[model samples]
Target: MSTNKVIHALYNDDDILMDAVKKVRAEHHHIEEVFTPFPVHGLDKALGLAPTRLAITAFLYGITGTAVSTWLTWYTMIADWPQDIGGKPSFSWLENMPAFVPILFELTVFFAAHLMVITFFMRSRLWPFKEAENPDPRTTDDHFLMEIPVEGNEDELKALLESTGAVEINVVEKH
Candidate 1:
């Protein structure tokens, strides 16, 4: 559980809020989190957060899916249950391989998509059948919020927020 008290600053304009965040980070160096209704360009650069790992995970998942699908199809069709068709010899790996390509492609796509979605949700802390923890409902609709954790000098923090053109400010004790 977190014990830091957070001060929330709400802004209607994302550009102003982004500037405020950069200013606050430059001045205070104690921002906890910022929440916005939608993706704001250049916000991640301003925050100095590392680039996302989703793409890497997705690529690995795609490779795994492709390999698994290919191996499974080959093993089942050629190795395990070899059946002669159209007077062609059974167990001819190259000859029967084309027939597995469609199913292989489908499985690869399916696994890549589904696994990437799972990875995204897990990494983002978002999941189906889970309640959202949106601090302000408006933060989901229109407002952008910057949450700065107060470290004994809240007055200065409040001043910094005000200087950044925060439309509203609220402080809550986190116990």
Candidate 2:
């Protein structure tokens, strides 16, 4: 597969970068990705990207994990191993719920954390031994990069980047 041509821009100000992003998006709706050195608030809204649902999934997984842990503990300790320890009631599942709550909570958090991490990794295609595709090394250090796939007028895009107060511009070819 042929990778798309990426035009990289380095910006110093967030407001300028935001304005540039708006202009680029308004004039041409073909921007592939934008990278910032620091977190820019409301950037996602500017990019028209939807809010993520990972927190919701994590909560649901936590609840499921809690339920499973509770059921398993109750079944094993109350139903299967019904031995009265210290003359306590053998079939007291509800009374001894407090004793098993810590384990249940821990398991729930563990499952939620692990499952959410896995979900994020799988969804983002990030895994072990995966090579990162970074257009410029400086982008991660201190410069913001706005990447546009070169599909139409190259001069117009270059002019747009220059007009947006980009300090530097570089055209990257895909392998």
Candidate 3:
């Protein structure tokens, strides 16, 4: 079995991390991943990642909820048992749409929120009892860590990282 070598660079501040990321990219080095204590705005764009499609999925889920709620309201209030509550027994969904507005809005929000969370978890490959992938616990507190695969230029990479204000750097082998 071949072992892959990677360099883990730790930084103290987010600003330094961002500058280091830009410099690493400028040198055509591929960054495998970055870990931070909190979200850093514009990091995804700096990493050259594509825009997420979660919003599109959310909209579709909302539409599905709307359709389901519409059908349910029609079947129960109009087709199955027409009730003459509020002095209106039109028995038509269109005529009684105002009454179903609340249900439609509520179900739409519910489905969108729930399904979006599920989709995010699935897409991220997150599951219960999964082992953590973080290389350093310090990154979860106040440090930032950047993982980069070593491509045979260890000395050059080390120099580059050191110049970028990395607080610490380590080389590790992964199976």
In lDDT terms, which candidate is top?
A: 3
Ten-residue segment with the worst summed lDDT in candidate 3? 86-95
User: What tens digits encode model 3's per-residue C-alpha lDDT throughout 99-165?
Assistant: 9999999999999999999999899989888899889999999999999999898899999999999
Winning model by TM-score:
3
Best first by lDDT, ranked = 3, 1, 2
Q: What is the lDDT of residue 34 in candidate 3?
A: 95
- Model 2: per-residue Cα lDDT over 12-122, one tens digit each: 778888998898888855667888777999888888788999989999999989988998888988998887776767688888787788889899999899999899999
Distance from true location, Cα of 3 in model 3, Å: 2.9
Clashing pairs in 3: none
For candidate 1, write residues 91-173 as lDDT tens digits.
Answer: 67677777778987888888889998887788778977888777889999999998877878788888888888999999987
Clashing pairs in 2: none
Clashes of each: 0, 0, 0
lDDT value for candidate 3? 0.94
Query: What TM-score do all the candidates reach, one by one?
Result: 0.90, 0.91, 0.96
Q: Give the candidate order by descending TM-score.
A: 3, 2, 1
